[model samples]
Target: MGALLFRLQQEPAWFVPLAVLGALHVAAVAFRILSHLVLLLRRPTDLCHRYGTWAVVTGPTSGMGRSVALDLARRGLNLVLVGRDPAKLQDISDTISCTYAVQTKTVVVDLALIATPQGDEALRLLRHAVAGLDVGVLVNNAGLAKPCAVYLHEADVEAWVRMISVNLWALTEVTAVVLPGMVERGRGAIVNIGSGTTLTIPSFPLFSIYAASKRYVTQLSRSLHVEYRGKGIDVQCQVPLFVETNMTLGATASRKRRSFLSRLIMPTSDEYARAAVCWIGHGPLCMPNLGHRLEWCICHVVPDWMLDELCLRLNLWHRVRFQRLRTMRASRTNVVNDGCLPCKQV
Candidate 1:
């Protein structure tokens, strides 16, 4: 024991530096994990009172957007439900009003029409919709993705245009319109829905454009958070993995199909939205769900090369599956069409 103590006292000079580095690494990891826990466990702010009486949510007819809108209404805030389909928007508005007893308004416009005359009119209509309201929160939740992952060269130009229009342009424009009012009021929260593809996946090969758009959202939210924090505004980019919605499953998917997928790999949109809203004032960026948070930790520890390889293979498999499903659907459609056709005179 005396000899061991003596040897420790005479340890190599490199030992001190190595020990310090190891200590620092451990401390950093502990701090990170602790902070994440605090954020997750923290009680949510009284958003309806803190921000204002009303919240505006884009794409509120479906998916996460719809869930968030309903959550906000349930929390005693009036809602402006914006979406492309007038009928769907009205239906959701009515539901929220009936269920939550909160005031609800609907805005119908196609965000994918950006840069066109129609797009300009849509923005005009949007501006008019929120003109005199106390719009306290803005959920920049509208986004678009390819029908199926494909090489950039094989993707449709029109689809790419629409994706950019909805994901980037619409978000920017809507934020621009809403932010001024918030700045003047000196209080608000903005939740920008982002995708985990850009954050956790190291290389999103076939979905490059969609990933890039989400990266823009992540950067925009972080920058704006820093820029506006002093002015009583909270900006957060909520990165989500798969959520059970028409966006993840095809729009035509049956209710049972969505339920099964939700059980297997995706959280329901309502579950995700509830978790995301609780994290609004926690930080500039967050993975709100427990499963996604764990996945994020795993992704960070894995080497970049390994992540890249995994992404490539997973996306390639998705591509193959998508193609097979498309082929099968086309075959069934053709069979149905043939059966329906009037018999031609021989």
Candidate 2:
């Protein structure tokens, strides 16, 4: 301080005042940044970025993850992109780097493998990839919807386990690895991408595991926000419904149970991704479409019984299509058995 004053003492009076003011402004910014850094370094758990420089984004292979990565790349931050397929990650990183002209690197570790009892093996690989860099932003977005078409009776246990691993455990493990540095630095952000299923009550009918997984994400995000709000760390939850992606293409047998309503107001993956990045950076939560809130408002005004009946009717209508097809099939069979080709009777 004395050295600074001595140098300033030799300056013109007008120059000295201007220099002092500029120095004060720079000091204020540095202090604010330092304070945030302090809070970030206090702990080492979950997704934290209190004192780091890199943003870690998972599932950069497609859909929301790919979209989110692209948007973040444009934001001028160096990124660590994670995905299962090495080639796919490389392809994505190349496209993003070439197109956005941003610093890019890829780390391919299957989140599913990272969550298992033998997960340490894969985690070791991931740890090696991220060992040198400090990750400040954790984007918890990779998840899977259960594959069920007609009956909830049939559940694929292996797939369910993998889903659980990817949807929840992968998020936690990566967060655990990155959070220590963030807490030590006291300046990070964790953005968990959740689903609107918790509120929409969509007759998505077969995504029991998917909905359950996202509810955990939503709850975890809220709890983290409340717990770490004072720590200069921001935990945000982004819940999107019916995003236009390959998952919701309606081409799959499992997602065929989607009601007309769900398939109607679906937003594009890009829209949801853009809103997610913007909101999670600023607040604890962000809902993309105003129409979803409006629909939610109407749903609240309507009686629960009415909604229930509407859902029930939709299910019945859905089943009736199969029933009518069955009726047609049986009638055709009977006609064939009776050796009557002129006209078929039910």
How many pairs collide in each candidate, listed in order? 0, 20
Which candidate's lDDT is highest?
1
How does each model score on TM-score? 0.87, 0.69
The residue-by-residue lDDT of candidate 1 on 144-195, one tens digit each, is 8874579999998988989998999999888988998899999999999998
TM-score of 2: 0.69
lDDT of 1 at 289: 80
Candidate with top TM-score is 1
Worst 10 residues of 2 by lDDT: 42-51
Q: All models: lDDT?
A: 0.84, 0.71
Q: What's model 2's lDDT at 108? A: 67
On residues 81-173, what C-alpha lDDT tens digit does candidate 2 reach at each position? 888898988988998888876677787677888755567776777677667676678887777764433355666677788888888898888
